[model samples]
Target: MSGERVGAAVTWGLLGAWVVHDLEELATVPGRLRRNVPQLRKRFPQVPERVWRRAETLGAAEFATAVGVMGAIVGTASAAGRLTGGRSGLYQSALTGFGLHGVMHMAQAAAVRGYTPGSVTSPLVVLPFTLWARGRLRKAGVLRPPRPRDAVAGTAAAAAATVASHVVARRLLGAARRTS
Candidate 1:
């Protein structure tokens, strides 16, 4: 297979895995909320049902989006680096991906908060899948000799994916809300 095709395959594979994780989280959100209700109420006396619902929706959307965006960024970067045969290309890609994560997450927070997106909670939420992708990349036969640069790239890519997913998911949510 061609290099770009290989990269795309890896990206899609990782994204698919993330979607599965999203589904699992959605299934458990209700129980998680039930368990945390008392604390939620105590912590935020003015909490609303809409907030809980939004959280649930965003959680699922973000996961899928993150996976998609991160996978794309990483695969593209790695492939490009390999094609060009530049030593720092991979590191540069990784750094870019890592930084992108912060951006995506911040955007998600803003979207969730209606423009004021508060402190950093997204990184915490998306970390699992991001980390999982990294692990998978290392083990996969197609993508060999994962480097330190990859770790950085993986992180940034994951963050960017988180943000991208959030934006897409939020738009979908808005459309659904309007129609419903």
Candidate 2:
């Protein structure tokens, strides 16, 4: 394969692996919150048990929705990247993924029926593993941090895994893409 093709393959491959890991980690976040709920309550005396319980129940739905929304947006961005014939699609798709996620999370929290345990503390609760995963990936020498000129490395990493999964789906059939 040509150098460009190799780059694309590696980029896609790395991104695919990252997406799998990200989804797995995302799946674990609510459970982690459940484990931390008592400590969180102890730390913030004003937070009620009812609030945490509600968040736990709602977390699955919220997370699923967020992932679905982000998946659609990022998929479009990735296709745009491919159609435009530029590698920059990877970066753009990544940015849209995390950016939309952040916005959705904030909106969910501010909107009615937003009472997830980690809603208010998502940054603190989520960032540690997020950081740790990035750090470990960097340590393992698979992915690198975004450059100063490219401020979207972390975001790209976040979307890489999801996009990778889509790529896999796109290979399956048109029907899968539509449903996905």
Candidate 3:
């Protein structure tokens, strides 16, 4: 495939992986956490059970919205890169961010010695897709091979976005609860 086509495929593949990963998390994460993470409630004693449940209920929506935002950013950056001779910093950042996210999921699974929320598909889907996308981006001259620092920074940015999404979700859920 041409560079632009490769980039577009990477973008779409990342989004698809995210949707599947989030669906896996939504289906199982809260229940798994309740069962496995012994210190969860103890660590956040201030959060009531009802609130926790509400957050859990909203998890999928929050994840979907965040992924959508990430997609828009990547798509816009990719388009710009195509228009401007393939200098897409945001696209590179996203590739690094998502690639590292796959690694994080694998690490989480390894630490627990079992399946964690997104673990089932992280290696099988996310990692491979992200790796291929990174390679395509490099071959296309849209980005260089990811560096350690770039990955770190990208992951940090992604983490911040995740936190922001959670905050927004919480507020929305809280409002809905109040109205009900």
lDDT of each: 0.48, 0.47, 0.67
Tens digits of per-residue lDDT for model 3 on 47-144? 68886665545555555555556555555655654554445676667657777887898897786676778887788887887778777766766666
Give the per-residue lDDT of model 1 (tens digit) for 8-101: 3333433343344444444544455455556555666677977655554445444454445545655565555445432235533453354344
| Number of clashes found in candidate 3 | 0
Pick out the ten consecutive residues of candidate 1 with the lowest summed lDDT.
1-10
- Tens digits of per-residue lDDT for model 2, 1-180: 122221332223233433443475466666766676676677667777787775455454455555555555545544544443334545344543444444445565564354443344334423333344334334434433456544455455655654555444444445555788
Q: Could you tell me which residue pairs clash in candidate 2?
A: 19-161, 55-116
User: What value does the lDDT take at residue 72 in candidate 2?
Assistant: 58
Off by over 4 Å in 3: 1-7, 39-87
Q: Which parts of model 2 have CA positions greater than 4 angstroms off? A: 1-15, 40-57, 89-149, 152-180
Model 2 earns a TM-score of 0.40
Each candidate structure's TM-score, on Cα atoms with residue i matched to residue i, is 0.37, 0.40, 0.73
**TM-score rank order:** 3, 2, 1
Name the better of 1 and 3 by TM-score: 3
TM-score of 1: 0.37
- Per-residue lDDT for 156 in model 2? 54
